[model samples]
Target: MALTTEASRYRPSAIWQLRLSLFMATYVLGASALYPEVFYTSALIYSHKFLVGIPVLFIGGVCCAALIHGRRQPVRYALDLAQGRWRGCLLVLLFFFASLTAFSTYKIAIPSVVPYYADNWLADVDEWLHGMPPWEIVHKLDSNNWSSVVFNSYEVIWFYQWFGTILFVSLWSDEIARIRYLCAAALTLSVLGTVLALALASVGPVYYHHFVGVDRFHGLNAALDRLDHSYMVREPAAYLLKAYQSGRPSLGGGISAMPSMHVAFAVLNAYLLSSINRWLGVLGWTFAALILYGSVFTGWHYAVDGYASIVVVSVIWWTTGRLVRE
Candidate 1:
């Protein structure tokens, strides 16, 4: 084929942005119609949590892109970057908001779709493998203060690495092809993971312990209770419990866990980071490993949930890679 500078090649197409925005609009409207309270709550959370970063990163990306492509007068280059990279930044913002909103909406809707808890089957599968759930395997470690610290801190990977990777790819990276791949792969893995989770949703071990009287995971339950008293991880679980008890709409309170999106996103982050830089990829993989272990150790998901998520994300990543090239 042909060679071109990074600034001159592989930018996202307008048609691609148009199609993605259309899908996002449809999802937001449909989700609002189905569950107005959940949609609104999620939107509010998104606005507060992620909206501030958009402008900062967008401007930074435009300046960087302009600097990279600076072959004209300063004012002229700034205007050109505004017309090009700034526009792309806005598109990236739209895609990010849309993807996150859809994810939160589906998380809220999961309980409605699968009303009954299905952890018994998953727990059984774990037992079939080793006669005990994965958390129990780590039960001995929970006694060590550092283990609790690690498990508590491990949850940060979900937000830090996942969102950080998105911003890095969209704003800092010169690889537009990588950005497109991530955009497509994120939606694909999210939708598929939600579908699979909804098919046979479960409240997971900790929730089951508190809500359904499944005493099988007592060791894991105790560890979570201890973490609640000291660690930041307890806050989300507290919110989930309150939402479950009050039956009120809350952001990120739903508890479906058949296939762990935490693990899926971790896998996607690792894959995308690997595509760009080896050291970044290693960091991403380290975070993924922690999340893979944390998903089971904290009783948020069965061991099999993480396993299945890895497989699913791997398939989507491979498929999206090919599609981005084409």
Candidate 2:
């Protein structure tokens, strides 16, 4: 389906714009007071990553839009960003920045606030759900190809799909649709997800095993160690282990893992894509399932974390959907 010609003219809702601006302003003030290093570091890091990725994103968007709609569609989008409708571009950038800030706040503040780990209770919940820890089952799988697939899907593919969706919708979809996704995502990742994560903070199986001498997850540890030796590229788990070993309070170095943002974002993406088409929605959901499985397989989260994330994001998406309709 094509974006409506009238809708193509971007005009953001004043209320949402003001709300977002206020949110960012408040965050900046609070972060500067409580965590000055995180405040500046997060701003620099997120801005650098966004700016570096924009050129490739823009070129890809232009090419894809040209093939789908026509050259004029891409040209209109470029002009809107540059001069024609700069507010539209500003709105997207603000939403993105706020999203990253939300993540930064969670990563920095949670560890500083809640130093206790909840892996014991969280692991019990996981056992209640799956008769055993999900990681135990996942670690049993052969590590030759599945390991690479799941690890890469969790690490690399997720980033591409997540940012790709944001870039595509911001440039190609009408303003209403784009705003709905942003609002839904903001609530899901920034507000609801972050709150839940902070409230029930725990490092996860790998850290639990490493720090606490809990042998419940030795299977996952062995599998990850094997992958580290086997894979050509450094595995995500190895990198995370290294970070934890370093013991330095780097930006986004906090370890709170009760509710998985990976699963929350995956579910949110699935729902958003469903609005575009059922098949795409199914694909999104499937990818989300893989991410959930990967989270367990890689020992980054308990199954309960992913389960809680699904429920949380579903509620946020439904609530935001109703608000948007109103």
Q: Give lDDT per model, in order.
A: 0.69, 0.71
* Segments of candidate 2 deviating more than 4 angstroms: 1-12, 71-87, 228-252
lDDT tens digits, residues 137-248, model 2? 8777756678888878987899889878877766744655666777777777656456777778788886786655678876666667787433423344456556556644
User: How do the residues 133-194 of candidate 1 rate in per-residue lDDT, one tens digit apiece?
Assistant: 67877655665465555565566547766665565556543554544665555565456555
Which whole-number lDDT from 0 to 100 does residue 118 have in model 1? Answer: 76
Model 2 residue 16 CA deviation (Å) reads 2.6
Top candidate on TM-score is 2
